[model samples]
Target: EAAVTQSPRNKVAVTGGKVTLSCNQTNNHNNMYWYRQDTGHGLRLIHYSYGAGSTEKGDIPDGYKASRPSQENFSLILELATPSQTSVYFCASGETWGVYAEQFFGPGTRLTVL
Candidate 1:
């Protein structure tokens, strides 16, 4: 089973400050993703990686950057935090990209930018 974990379950940042959210997985899966969930919108993908050393921008990568230094770790970086970026972020991992493949989610990190 894929197990994903995220740090700093809650965060508060000032506008223009930098923020880094970390995620780690123990499933040895090939795919990892970062997504943010807002009140009325579906989970929008920000970035994803096929494996370590590779990162791919997803549907909404505008204000975020992603890093995958190793198969077990991934991080999301916000260069300049803004109130608009405040949202619940989730990290997920899956063995495959097919619709049938279940993606495991970590306890979300709620971020608030003032």
Candidate 2:
């Protein structure tokens, strides 16, 4: 099974400042994704990677940067965080990008930008 972990589970950032959220997976899944969901909204994809060194823009890529330096590490960066960007961020890993690929989600990073 996939075991994903995220760091600094909770964060508070200032407007126009920087914030970084990190994620690591143990199961060696080939696909990794970053998502943000507001209190009453669905999962909004921020970024995704098919493998190391390859990153793709998802549904909501603006104001976010993503890095996949290794097979096990993926990071989400907010260069200039805004209050509107604050939300629960999630990291997920999957073996494939098909319909049947069950994504394993890590604990969310709750960000509060003031």
Candidate 3:
């Protein structure tokens, strides 16, 4: 099974500042993703990476960016943080990029903007 880990667990950020969230996966998966969970919007993918050194913009990539420096690590960056961007974020890893691939999720990170 894939194991994913997220750092800090919680974050508080000021407007217009930069915030970074890190993720680590131990299953040697090729596909990794970053998502945010909001009340009405549900879970939305913000960024994803196919493999090391390759990051791709997801469905909602505005105000955010992603980095995949290696196979076991992925990071999500908020360059110009805003109040509207405050939400719980999650990181996931999958063995394959398909409907049937199993995805493992890390503990959610609650981010608050003020």
Candidate 4:
């Protein structure tokens, strides 16, 4: 089975509060990522992992932390969130970064920070 899933599909956070979004992939892919979608910026990467216990900062890593406890699990944490962080977040699992690599995405998570 191939699937990517995200928890707390919808979230409302208060400014300066803590927020954590979780993701799981059953695809057993070697790559996982966290991204935020905004109107003008399109989709911006926040954090990613190559595999268990391996995390890398993405295009926009500020204000975010990522954890990869195992091959199937990845999480994004915002210790002090802000309204500017409000956006639709997505988690994806992929085999690699190339034309032949296939990626599966979790149903988007809507996060609104007030």
Candidate 5:
């Protein structure tokens, strides 16, 4: 089964602080993604990687950066956390590009920037 896990399920940070959210997958999939979920807006991708050592910016990558150092691990970094960055973040993994590629998501990490 494809499984994704995230650490620090909930976080409270002060503005301008740095925050790092980690994600790991056990499915050995080739694609991993980081997204933020906000009320009324569907999941917006922040960054994604096709495999290790390849991080690509997604639709909303302005205030975020991502890293994929190995097949099983991906991380999202918030250089200067802000109140607007407060949202639920989710990590997902999927197989290679295909018509049927479906992403399996982690529980989520709720971040609150004060």
Candidate 6:
């Protein structure tokens, strides 16, 4: 089965502090994504990478950044954490199969900024 893991499952940050969320996948999938879930916004993509050493901005990339150093490791960095950015973050991996791709998601990382 495809598995994805995230570090620091829970976080509490100050308004101006920095926070980093790490994700690792064992699926060997080439496409990885980071998303945040909020009350009304649902799941919004923050960042994504097609493969190792490649990073791309997602639909909502304003306050977040991502890094994909290897096939299994992907990281999300919040240079300046803020209360408005606090949300449940998830990491996912997917691969093309036939005409569509299926994604496997990690548990999630709940972040709270004060």
Best model number under lDDT: 5
lDDT, candidate 6, 50-113, per-residue tens: 9999999999999888999999999999999989988999999998676449899999999999
Winner on lDDT (5 vs 6): 5
Per-residue alpha-carbon lDDT of model 4 for 20-112, expressed as tens digits?
Answer: 999999988989999999998888999999999999999999999999999999999999999999999999999776774877899989999
Cα lDDT listed for each candidate: 0.94, 0.94, 0.93, 0.94, 0.95, 0.94
Where in model 6 is the C-alpha error above 4 Å? 97-100
Could you give candidate 3's per-residue lDDT for residues 1-114 as a string of tens digits?
558999869999999999999999998889999999999988999999999999999999999999999999999999999999999999999866467498899998999999
Candidate 5: where are CA atoms >4 Å away? none
Off by over 4 Å in 3: 97-100
lDDT of 1 at 26: 96
Please state the error at residue 67 of candidate 1 in Å: 0.3
**Candidate 6 lowest-lDDT run of ten:** 94-103
lDDT of 1: 0.94
Least accurate 10 contiguous residues by lDDT in model 2? 93-102
Error of 1 at 94 (Å): 0.5
Report the candidate with higher TM-score, 3 versus 6.
6
Stretch of 10 with least lDDT, candidate 3: 94-103
List TM-scores for all candidates, in order: 0.94, 0.94, 0.94, 0.94, 0.96, 0.95
> What pairs collide in candidate 2?
none
Q: Highest TM-score: give the candidate number.
A: 5
